[model samples]
Target: MLITDDDEGDRRLVARALKEGHLSCECVEATSIEEAIFACSEYAFDCAIIDYRLPGRDGLDGIASLHQRFPYMSIIMATGQGDANVATEAMKLGASDYIAKAQITGGSIRRIIENALEKAAMRRKLALQQEELENFAAVLVHDLKAPITSVRAFAVLMEHSVGAEITDKDKLIGQCRRVANAARRMDDLIDTVREYTRADGQLLSGPVEMDRVIEDTLSNLHQMLLLRGARVTHGRLPFVLGNASQLAQLLQNLVGNGIKYCEAAIPTVHVEANPDENGAWVFAVKDNGIGISEGYYQQVFQPFKRLHDKSKYEGTGLGLATCKKIVERHGGRIWCASADNQGTTFFFELPACPAIA
Candidate 1:
């Protein structure tokens, strides 16, 4: 920890309080903003307890400079002055917490430090979640607009054709087909968006049976599976600690990818599970179908990233991304490996759950 104070007596008092509080921390002392900056540059401190009034510069300036250099470091402002405005200004300048030097005691210092650390952790978590939401919204807007525009353009063309003297049966049929296709595209986009939003990382606390999840996912897409003439086989699977619904969604996306991205006349999908070196359950979904290119392996996991044309494959490009989000929420990871026309294999690892006694 870094402690910044110009007064020798005040620094000694704070150190004594910390010792009495049993807060075992390795502290480095700095008397001014420049010293504080130099100390921070040399070492990473968990938290900085800084005096708001220094010899040369305002304490708020120190807080701002430290914040720029160590964005994730927690800082608490300690000032003898009881001015409420000073505390507010210090906080606005990036102080994580504030304390009055007059009120400094072993008990109060301990509580303040604990509370400041907790708040800092919460702030970081919330920021990460907010960033994810923003990215999801941006992708949703960019991807959803294309289908909407297509639907509108098709609708306008149909309206104009109805009023025109072009009575050719083939032209009329083509116009109607275009409108129908556009409407279906819009419907698919809306459905995919709804699914993506539904998987909002709200994982439940329980043991999820992967065997049941896989079976249910296959059942849900039974019609599609049959239409594609795909044969899916699975070995004995394991249970994992996570939400059942989310696990099912993850399996469904992998299975669907296997069935859809096929070059074989009859697609073959194999679902297998094994234990990794870390004892995690590594589930692999292998498909004898058209494979993804090496260059686009990582890109395929990004939202709204379509390696193939929408004309050939019907998807909103959120399937893999949703899989990734769900797995991560369950404290797991999902990835794919494939080469062009060599088929594809998707592997996801989840925390292993011991068998119920």
Candidate 2:
């Protein structure tokens, strides 16, 4: 923890009060903003308590600089008596909390610090939620707009060429196909979003039979596999502790993506598992496709993030995000390894079932 105070007596008083309050902290003292910055650079402090009055610059001015430097660190500004305006401005300038130095007590200071920490944590969580909501909204708009635009364009062409002497049969058929594909894309977006949200929060934990899940997933995606002429090969997969339905969905999404993104190449996907050092099974879903770039390895797992053109690869972009959520729900980690054109392998780990152990 960092404490900045210009007066030696006030600094000592704050330190003594914290000690009397029985709050154990590795406190670092700083007399000015520069000293505080140096201390912050040297150590990772949980919170910084700053005195309102300083020699060259006041605490309110320092709040902005400190906040910019360490945005996540909680800051509590200490103001003198009857300095309500200063306290208010400190908060506006990104101070987490403020206290009047005249009213300082051991218990009051401890409670204030605890309150600041709790509020800071809540703020960070809200920020993350807002960002996720914004990302979803942006993607929803783009995905929805693309299909509607395609449908409208095709409809306009068909209407203009209807009953015309120069009507081309092949062109009309091509336009109808485009319209049908666009409608399918729209329907897929709605279905994917519905299913993604439905299973997102539901955690069904059990001894999930790996073989049964794979068989069911393959059955569900059989049509797509046939349409794409994709072949899946797998060896013996071990049973693990997880939700059966979610695991099936996870594999289905991976396999579906593997087939869809192949760019005319015959899709060949392999599913295999091996035991890790910690008794957990590391499963890999390897696919021979037009692989993803190294920079987008993590981005592809984000909802509605697409590295390729939507026309080339038809999807709501929620498949990998759903897979990630499922893996996290099962207390596992997921990652990818791939080059630009060289195939990709997605690896995830799950704990072995107790019976198997």
Candidate 3:
């Protein structure tokens, strides 16, 4: 797992504890926050143990960066000094757990790592179960709504033929149609629930080129690009460590996002990537579409949330939320930068996959 600490003594202590406990954790050492992130490029680990007191960098800021790229990887902060307030801030900044440096040990260290790993496993399992339930509910709703829609259609046809002179026929048909429409909407919601809440299926990992992943993601969204008249361009990107299937889904969500909410005449989405000051990969998907309001920036990631009315747009609202899940699973964080009508940029950073020899 990713291990970062400016304290050489402390780093070794934690490493030995993990080893002695037979945790199978390879301690990748980092003297600074930037170096710690670079270590991610070398290999993708299941968790990250960071020093809350990294001397030069505030522990919380470092955790924020790591959390964005490595959302799925459990991270704990190690600090020698702190009250409840500092510990609270660390967790707010996305730390999975907190450990005081003075408290580091073989036995405690083993337990911490074990606990984090176990928690990750539990979350994945829960997601799978939840997706199965959603899929089942969606199917049930669809079956129930079919007859309602047919009834509404027949009512409309009779009303149209009978006209207003047919007494209560028009009003009765109108009411039936409204009820049918609501049922159809519930059907849509059920489907979105399944789409957004649906399990990510599964992922297969390997050394994949970034350009290839982008191409594949774009290919899947060919229909959206045509409909929205949005064009995307980016420079050559180097290979990063991750599952190609998961990465494709990641890009699909980003591009589909450009099509869904933007009200601009022509939407333009741009993709770019580069090695940061630290060697990790940072990629951005910028769009010249309708920008999201500041207040909704964080809320947009919440499941089943939409900034617009359902009448105005058709979506499961689970798209970006799902994107957030995928990014975190790969040890990355995702956030948006946008202003009214200026468009928005959804950026995420993932550590480059370590080169296999």
Candidate 4:
């Protein structure tokens, strides 16, 4: 390990302290960023302790340079206790830990260094797991496309082969259509799960107009809406950051649930957004349908967890799960507020908009 500071005396003092504290860390003194890089090229190090105030270069600048070359190396920033902003910036710049220069004794410094090393190890393990999951998802999704394509091809052929003049043609065609829909649902569930479980996550979020997203989702569900006489209304809305496809899917799940569970009355769904106390945007999907029980709220978010039997609801149970993932990925939280028959409101919150365009 290397410890760099503009003060020669401080470097020696820290090195001696660490050595006495049973740390086998080989201390390298670099008063400037250039010296730090030179030391790194000259010898290998598991970590680097950078002082916030360095001559000719700030600690964060040196850390940035070091990170580009040695991303695996743990970085611990030394800062004055009063400089909270500097410490926060260092952490955001990927520093493993921040130590208050005045408060850190020799022993405390060693402990910090050890803790940083442990964190680095855990991060590496997470990276490996993420890679494995990505590889698995890519293969699984790609493999699924082949069989689904064949099934769809055969289904279309059957539809054409059976003439409309034949009796029971409508019934037979509807049954085949149902099978095709089921296959498509499976594909959608697999793709959504694959995207959600990603380690770095699906960074597909972009500027999404509120009205456009809801309009598009509802348009796609036009047949179902018409069949159930579901009315969806909205008012003036704000543009938010989100992925259009994922947003449409999330909406489809919530609104579609309302349509599927509606009793004798026409299904009514509404979408709206407002600002919360934290200044973040809060969106809620309200539905007038068979409402979910309070005890099932938590369970609904789990993949394939259904409150009603498959015969009654007619779902694969991945819709709400996908919604949960999408909301969480956007730095938001979602929960259901509802009473049976009265209605259900699924509310979700997204972080405050970026200050800049």
The candidate that wins on lDDT is 2
After superposition, candidate 3 runs with Cα above 4 Å error? 1-202
Task: Look at candidate 2 and tell me the lDDT of residue 74.
Answer: 90
**Candidate 1 lDDT over residue span 1-357, tens digit each:** 888999988898889889999999998999999999999889988899999889888799999999888877899999986778988988898888899999999999899988888877888889888887798789888776876787688778877888886788788788778878778877888888777777774666587888898899989989988898889999989887778887888889888888888878998899999989987888999998889888998888887888989889888899998898888887788888898899999998888876641
Task: List the global CA lDDT of all models.
Answer: 0.86, 0.87, 0.77, 0.78
How many collisions between residues are there in candidate 3? 13
Candidate 2: segments with Cα more than 4 A from true spot: 9-28, 33-45, 56-71, 78-93, 97-115, 163-170, 202-204, 235-241, 263-266, 275-280, 309-312, 351-356
lDDT of 3 by residue, 226-331 (tens): 8888787877877887777777778888877876668877777888887787677889989887898898899888666678876688665667877887787777
User: Largest TM-score belongs to which candidate?
Assistant: 1
Worst 10 contiguous positions by lDDT, candidate 4: 192-201
Cα error, residue 69 of model 2, in Å, equals 6.4
Cα-based lDDT at residue 292, candidate 4: 83
**Per-residue CA lDDT of candidate 2, range 62-140, in tens?**
8989988887789999867757788789999999988888767889789888888887788878888789989888879
lDDT of 2: 0.87
User: Could you estimate the TM-score for every candidate?
Assistant: 0.83, 0.77, 0.53, 0.53
TM-score of 1: 0.83
